[model samples]
Target: MAARRKANRILAAVLVPLTLLTLAGMAMLWPSGSKDGISLANPYSAAPGVTFDTGKIQSVVEESCMQGSTAPGQSPDTGGQPAPAGSDCMFAFTEPDQGGSPVKVVVNPEVAQSHGVKPGDQIRYLNLSNAPGAAASQGSPAYIFVDFVRTLPIVILALLYALVVIAVARWRGLRALLGLVGAYFVLAGFMLPGLVEGKPPLLLALVGSTVIMIGVLYFAHGFSARTSTALLGTMFGLAITALLAAWATDAANLAGVGSHDATTLINTSANISISGVILCGLIISGLGVLNDVTITQSSAVWELYELAPGTSARKLFTSAMRIGRDHIASTVYTIAFAYAGAALPILIIVMLYDRPLGDTLTSAELSEEVIRTLVGSIGLVLAIPVTTLIAVLVVKATGVRTAGQSAVGVPDEDRRPHGTSGAGAINADDVDDTGALAAAAFERRSRQSTEGSADPATTRRGRRADRG
Candidate 1:
């Protein structure tokens, strides 16, 4: 008990101060509401007499790629050059939701060739019918496809995911979902704004991630030695991941130059550092997987100790690590496959290039994902044993009891059934009353069978009858 108290005190000493410091950092680094430094062009910001409207596709048709059909952000052909034979474009006839005549909208060529729209699909379009030059040009374009409306399907999937989680895990799952919301709140409210203000990326990620874990762990799992142990393990893993990510981002030169979005950010804002963003991403990407392994390892240790209360600390750790080994194997694959799936398009593009494996992997396009998987796997793999050891020590300190005695090194008397003087009885006191009763009954039956098997008169009678 005293040892457990000491462990708790140590955890508090570490966590409480860290949390206070993180909060202070957040307060100091909070962003101002001004957007003075941002100068990115907005594509969807409509000019006078132009509107962005939603509509449902009435029908789609493939027509010749001619001079008049212009896509969004495309200018009308003024060279008077005829389109090549066999070239075509997709045009969707759509009815506006705001009560207007059906208009023919030209779909973007990339969208049309990749994922063409059909009738009854909701879409957003830029309506330039009332613009100044609309009446001057011949066959001037009116509506152009901007994007597909995807709100309904996304909302449906989200609801289904929530229902399944809550249905299976009940109130705990609900609390976890709520904690996820809180985590996002911190990410959006504190961390993102801080990044926008050009705060230190490494410190921003670490503080934000730690605050998230602390909130989610206690809020979802509640306050206990087990949870605290898991929290400590998670923090340790976070620190390792952060340090490695910072080094890898610099050493590997993950400048995010290969990504279009990254390039846009470079052209858009001077304050944002692509390398720093990549560094922050590398750290944040591993948080969920790290937390999973650590908490699971901690729980496995405690459960092992509960099942075999007399087990030595070393044995308990060994048993727990057996589970941890399996978790580590699966979690590594999980991180690898998850990143692979997200980067599948990039992989396909690189594969088509038919480049050497090493070259492809080390390329700017693929290097970040590769490094992310490796770094996350390393952090989580190291956390497993640490969590297992901490849990073993804590469980050993708070030893289980039976009849006012520690279950570890239990007395012989306590190992036997009450009101009986028989050998071969297992330790009934190690388990609850119901299990103890079942053990005693089984022992009694075994003793009776042994006595019957040793009856000399009965054996002789059976042998004589068989001979006759």
Candidate 2:
């Protein structure tokens, strides 16, 4: 019991100050929300006398490419070129959501050639019917396809995911989901804006991620020595990941080159550093996996100790690490495969280049993912043993008997042999603890009448009967 209190005090001393510092960092680095540096044009903003509207596809017709027809995302000044032999122009006849005549919407060439929409598909389009040039052209295009409406499908999947998680894990699962929402809130509210405002990327990521982990671990798992140990482990892993990412980003020259989005950000915002953004992304990407391994390892240690309280600390540590090893193996593959899946398109493109393996992996286009997998893997792998050790120490201090009595709360004599009596005799306190209750039950059975058991051999046989 004393040892448990000591551990709690130590954890409190460390975590409380860290939390305060993180809060201070967040306050200091909060974004001013000034849009002075962002010069990107908003394409979706409608012009005077024109509106963006949604519609259902009534039919699609193939025709020769028209020089004046506008395509989705195409600039108005540079119109479509003459149609190639195999690439005929396609247009969708859509019934607008607002009561009106069916409009002919020109589909973008990429979409028309790839996954063209059929009848009954809902899509958003630009309505240029009332624009200034509507009456000037011989046959002015009135509508242009924007993108598909995906709200219904996305919402359905989200609800189904929530139901399954809640049904399987109950209250804990619900808390986990809520914690996820809060984590995103922090990301969107604090970290993203801070980055845009040119805050120190490494510090912003570390502080923001730490704050997220603190909230997520405590809210989802509750306050306990076990949770505290896991949180500490998570912090260590996060720090390691940040440092590795910082070094890797610099050494590999990952300046977000060869990416269209990165180029766009560079062109639009002079304050935002593409490399810093990548650094932040590399660190943030590993948080989920890092937290998973730390918490799981911590829980594994506690459970192993509880199931066998008499096991030596060395044995306990060994057993817990066995579980950690399996986790490490599986989680490494998980990180690698997850990154691979997300970057599959890039992978296919790279493969077609027919470059050497070394050059291919080290290229700016692919090195970021390779480094991400390695850095995240290293951080999480190190955290497992650290979490296991902490959990083992804590569980030994609080969960098991120290000398002859319960370390949790019970008295010494309560654990004495079945028929013994002392100051620690079974009482209401015994009922409060599971281990104490089992001992008390055995004591009561021993005190019961010994009728029909005169022969010692016969009583021994009766005891062994259940073993068979």
List CA RMSD, all candidates.
Answer: 8.1, 7.8
> Could you tell me the TM-score of candidate 1?
0.84
Deviation in angstroms for 208 in model 2? 0.1
**Model 2, 433: alpha-carbon shift in Å?**
27
Residue pairs of candidate 2 with colliding backbone atoms: none
lDDT of 2: 0.82
- Candidate 1: Cα lDDT at 355: 100
Per-residue lDDT over 156-187 for candidate 1, one digit per residue giving the tens place of the 0 to 100 score:
99999999999998998999999999999999
lDDT of 2 by residue, 40-146 (tens): 87889888978899999989888655523554434444345545576456788889898787777888988977998899999999988788877676345678889
Worst 10 contiguous positions by lDDT, candidate 1: 428-437
Q: Highest TM-score: which candidate?
A: 1
Instruction: State each model's CA lDDT, in order.
Output: 0.81, 0.82
